[model samples]
Target: MTTTGKIVIVGGGVTGLTTGVALLEAGLPVHLVAAEIPGPTSVAAGAMWGPYLVEPWAKVRRWSLVSLDVFRGLSDAPATGVRMVSGIEAARNAVSAPEWNTLLLGFRECSPGELPTGFEGGYRFTVPLIDMPVYLQYLLRRFREAGGTMQRQFVGSLDEIDDGSVIVNCAGLGAGELAADDSVRPIRGQHVVVKNPGITEFFSEDTGLSPDLVCIYPHGETVVLGGTAIDGEASLQEDRVAARAIVERCAAVEPRLAKAPVVASRVGARPTRSEVRVEADSRSDGAPVLHNYGHGGSGVTLSWGCAQEIVQLVTATG
Candidate 1:
């Protein structure tokens, strides 16, 4: 078969799905393949807003801005459970260059009441938090509606995508092995989803302690309490110790949540790199490949913008 009519995308994570949506929007056909059951997106406690947190990837902040608008415009925003939320983001002392604070609406000082212990002072901003399970389903639905196709198979290398002239790789942590990308290591994040009706808002702080900071956000049926960032860790076995640590730290931040029933615990390895990669390159076997991985902890936060860039790269090459 000739490798020219369609584009093949590897991976079914948030990055892959969003890139598929963007490419379809740009008038292209896509075939997405993954090893596991094509499932929903997940991991992490809260989605941090603004560009300041992303460090050198200042474009990530811009991409996040555009992505928020895209998600807000989607017809299923309410059905998919995405919400424009306000949260308290604190820091003990400011980093030399914050990447995102100034980019948000109402980015200003948090009132004395919102301040948690150990935080000197910080800002409050309204940002979008993605309920990944819902959002991933939304993206998959859109891709199917746009005439995209999916295959269930593990692609161990770039050669497996020979059905297309161009392949966009968004394979998350798999890139570490598949692409021989040493930078694409996993950052393990553990969180607890609880049944808490009393916690209606999101609260977070930069506490320098075990399990580090705490963030609590409501997602319709469940409340997300999180989390800890264990860099270079790739275990998804749901550590009981980590789960208990998350719950305790979160309750310490918001005493009311202490009474909430823990519904379930989840662990995911975030595909992390020093920077978010959304550039075009050739695979080892000389297949045209556009890489759109390394989202780290911000995959959902900046999906659309990076997708847009990926689509542009593919289109320009085509």
Candidate 2:
């Protein structure tokens, strides 16, 4: 009943699974316990590798870059559900390139003709687009192969962890309660999946200025059209109106999406904060605990980087 010598990790989403892999690689016995695997949130993500809404530019850049490399290595491994796809991000105005742009393949400013009407500028790059369900399963298989253990249950708080084990909290939004973090809140996102209309690439626009999402992520026979990032809202109910809006906007960008039959709708509550927490802390009794959550929309994009740092923190503090 005790995992005294094991490194216990909470959460079974991408973050926790990725952490388990990294910890096992660092030669540590791992025990992962979470309420869900291939979690409700991550499974609903329109997950592409872009540092969209995470913070601390320097750390985000570093973490995203490391993850980019890791994902690229997995691109050819079809079972992993990762693909290197070219996409365009249209900006209403000119902007500087992202710091991690140097790490992507074929990243460059878009040509004048490439910009859709009303877009002043944009950039095209090839980045890793993840099919979360498949990728999460792959992570689970890889974790077990590395000799890690997992349990399906709810953890009330950090105090429940075994006394002699070093704990890593990759508990995503649940960290709000587990770690007493008031800063962590949900940024609700929704996506609509449709039968692919033979679209071969991906497309997205910054939804900050716009009131709705205009994006399309074609994954083989199923193309994902989304989405909505309504901050502080965590409801998972299917919003027909919102789904309609997503389809309409995406269709305006890619006409084929207008006719693709709606296959499904997904919802997720992303853990958002001013910045990601990837540092070592302690419990009331001074037991070592390392936090690795608040990744917002960049959980997959920052997974390996944060996991690598978690390993370093454990090595230094263990």
Candidate 3:
């Protein structure tokens, strides 16, 4: 538990911050460097617990289950901006319960009336819905309290972070350049935030297999409507066309959304890979490194577990 060495975490989104905080709390000196920490992407996440579109389903399920419990506990802390909300995932076709459903709270098959029209089958469950901006602030606060420090610096390469500790690469899309990972591409996502319209629960149509994206997540006084997933598109430019489509599609699920006044619109490019890279690497000089990025759309879902894994990996050799 002593300060074995200084750990440098690259990237400032959920993954980087979570890993940095975990390592710092484990009594290791940690520092974070990033071009945009808590940048557009992490803040623009739909920020749900579902393991949507993440590969290597086994590992993702394990990580997601761990994060679910952690976020559930954090829900009690007002500043964490996490809450256990019950919601129904309506599927256009019949689908069996996902294996990971058992790990969640209040799992149930929805009755016909419980389902929104056009969804032939669905399930209801309670999962952690995070208000990302608040949660990130809470994470930064906790990390500072744990003696972690951050620098707003850009890292052109891992060698630039050689400060006597293994570098943990949570650099997200930058991995395409930072780690020279060509497999890492961006899945651009957009969201529409509107007045809550008194919606208390959440609703999402499982469009994972389909191209259409439709979801309504109500957090307090606002509902986060989402989204689009266009692969290889890294543009952060807001698309008014996409925004209107998101609202129109979301309104189909919840009628009130049709008249809700639009509050804001945002965009983010999810760093995606066929499988998330969470393993050890080495430099030409054999300097140890840990790669943990390319989470696609499930960074929030897998943050805690992956962060904990980073801690274990560091401790095993520290």
Candidate 4:
């Protein structure tokens, strides 16, 4: 049976939607309140790969793995836009890095001939990529069917929730304000969407260049080519210089993409923190408040695992 009290989830991004879906599936009555209209992350290029220049949180990786499986199991909602993708990682340097090396499936030494670059070896593996748009709609539909209620009301504070109700803060960067988390800063990521190049794989490079770098992932109708990680930058404006650099870099990697037409550009701020917060707080009336944001560039990569833990936190509280 479902629980007795109402559970309100804040933020309409991946974390909020996934938490709502999990709760509803478990027969819990849920209500979602957001100050903004839901749009893009659900329809993202959806590539779930990781272990790059940065050392990601272990829990985050675990959650991403679990989410990878969940997205893989769903068949009917092909539009939820999830798919398993094989990826290749190559470095221009010969130095071996253990942390990133171990994350791949076939972590091995590449022959000189195979090592086609400015220097080093390579690795390969497969992971899930979620089409955020399809997944978001699917989530909304599922929540509605399970009797969950959602509104466009922007919650100013945790006290705005009713007494005795559990409030989950999944407001993404908005949590910096909503949860009073000063560490939550916006890491802006910009992408260029192009017509499909008929490529099914994902390729990325990390030379630690200037304003941007190249990341190419092919989806159902289009290919995502881009990425500039501008920390503390909140401007949603498109960076054409960065966009052109990305296109040029990507085209250099695989010249075929050069011919594809640019359909659109996207800018999203990855909510980053020194540590991803997923703990319980309390409303003024002593109602439980669960904080679950800060997945940064890995939100899609880590949704389910985080939601599962949040469910456990809420369940244990009762």
Candidate 5:
């Protein structure tokens, strides 16, 4: 729709930044405000591009595929920190192939020999694995270069935003308070970064419905080992116990990780909901509002697709 001012996007994680970039690329004026841009949580992700624990498979499938295509294009640019890496996602118990397997390149069931020692069933495919820290900066730079502006300030409530601007509520976990969305809660995730001992491919355990996850993602010199998904847990403090467990679990699957020196630990609370929110609303002051959060573990996986949808929502409003 026709706007009197620039679009204001809340939350500055991958969701907000990606949305900001999309809007700018669409030739719209955009302003992003957040307490912290390039949010720590986004930086701390084991951000391989397979939809993990997000929901509403129908829409997620579409969004994830769109993002997969975009990431594939971005992979050609090393500065974007996107890579097309082949990997195995296996399970210790018998399981059906993932419904989205057909969406990836070179989709195939892993042969028994291809499966790690204890994995009973799994699939092999190539997907974009992101180095989040570098990627976030790339997004930020792209946003600024496109003439988008940002403010590093706390946005307490939607009511405080009275400007006649379209509001994109990407506040993530903060949406629980800003939008009064009780369904929005935190799913605590922890990852351990270890020195990469000459590894190239990625590996993940298909731990369905389990709080603990086993995954190893190598990014050049460092590998990110993950993770835990504790629902309703919001604390960002590093959990040594969880870190140790992550390293041990990964080491079991990839013996080379056994002696990898510990580098760092990361903890983030995924903004999880019963289903992802990517729709429109209105503020009390009658300003247009678009909700785009609750991505859970698939924030990076769904960022671009969701951003594109937001762009359409903005156009429809006009």
Candidate 6:
């Protein structure tokens, strides 16, 4: 199952692009094929550096920490669209600190006065807040600069690709059909973008298993307010009602947002599974295939770590 052929990566979202960059930097020949580059799901993310609604806690924690380290280094370069921002993540109900709190900078328990009106418990920390649109482009440029090639084509099946090259599937939601894995499903997320009202920090309400989420991530001039997480919803169309609710919820947390004018709206269907799948498989023809998808809402948070693991798998199998 090993030969001297270039690595063929499927899907051009953050997962695929980041994987390509890692492989190319590792000095492997790589080519990417996807239906869309800077995938809508990745771009639409209100991408803060925190593991949300992801599973297999032990591995997720390790992967998230690895990504956090990379993002911290990237924060120094503004062109990468990664910024170290201070913020509060509080919940309406009393809660204990998360085990990963120690991994963040400036980790502290929020004083009662610092907690927003309804939040009964929370924490203060500094983490990378990625502006996805800019960050995705950065990844693409880095990928190309590393001598990686890209082809804009939809992959209907893994068998269709018979180039004799090892395949890495990062098809996100599309993996459901491609891998015939029924566990993968869509968790639709919507967010509202508004002109920043001089806000420099981020704020998020810890919405435990609830479908409705409240988070505000500001990217300089524009702030992304999110959102709703409806399981089994795959539509990418913007929901005006959801947009308005997002703005209202964010405004309730930060009064200045009440007057902020609407800049745009975004909708993305997060590819979710009971647990993230990052394993190796072989096609009927014996070509090795690596699966790297189902990061759920933490695609950006887990990208680098997952990619690094994929590179390891490639190295190990060879």
Q: What TM-score, over all chains together, does every model reach?
A: 0.90, 0.95, 0.96, 0.88, 0.97, 0.97
lDDT of each: 0.73, 0.88, 0.87, 0.72, 0.91, 0.91
Predict model 3's lDDT versus the native: 0.87
Angstrom error at residue 44, model 4: 4.9
- Give lDDT for model 6: 0.91
Instruction: State model 1's lDDT.
Output: 0.73
Q: Which is the winner by lDDT between candidate 3 and candidate 6?
A: 6
Q: Give model 2 RMSD, 1 decimal.
A: 2.4
Q: Which portions of model 4 show Cα errors greater than 4 Å? A: 1-3, 37-46, 51-56, 75-77, 95-119, 208-211
**Which regions of candidate 6 are displaced past 4 Å?**
1-3
Model 5: per-residue Cα lDDT over 151-267, one tens digit each: 998999987776538999998899778888898989999999999999899999999889999999999999999999998899999999888889899999999999999999988
Each model's number of backbone clashes? 4, 0, 0, 6, 1, 0
Worst 10 residues of 5 by lDDT: 158-167
42-106 per-residue lDDT for model 6 (tens digits): 99999998888788889899899889999999999999999999999999998888777877767
State the lDDT of candidate 1 residue by residue for 1-318, as single tens digits.
Answer: 123368889988878888887888778888899875343225343554444234346587679878878766663458665777777767666522235666666778876677876666767777776676666777778899998999888889887667887888888888666667897887788888898766656776655443354788777677888887787788877889878888898887777777788998877887888888787788777777888888777777788888988876766633
Candidate 4: tens digits of C-alpha lDDT, residues 1-318: 124788889888878888888887777788888866463443442345453332245765676567756876753357666776776556776545445445445555546775334636555566665555666777778778889888898778877777336788999888878888898898777888889878888876555534566677877788888778788887778888888877888888778888899988888877888778888787666666889987777776567878998888877742
Clashing pairs in 5: 1-318
Residue pairs in collision within model 4: 35-154, 42-132, 42-133, 43-132, 43-133, 46-129
Badly placed stretches (over 4 Å) of model 5 are none
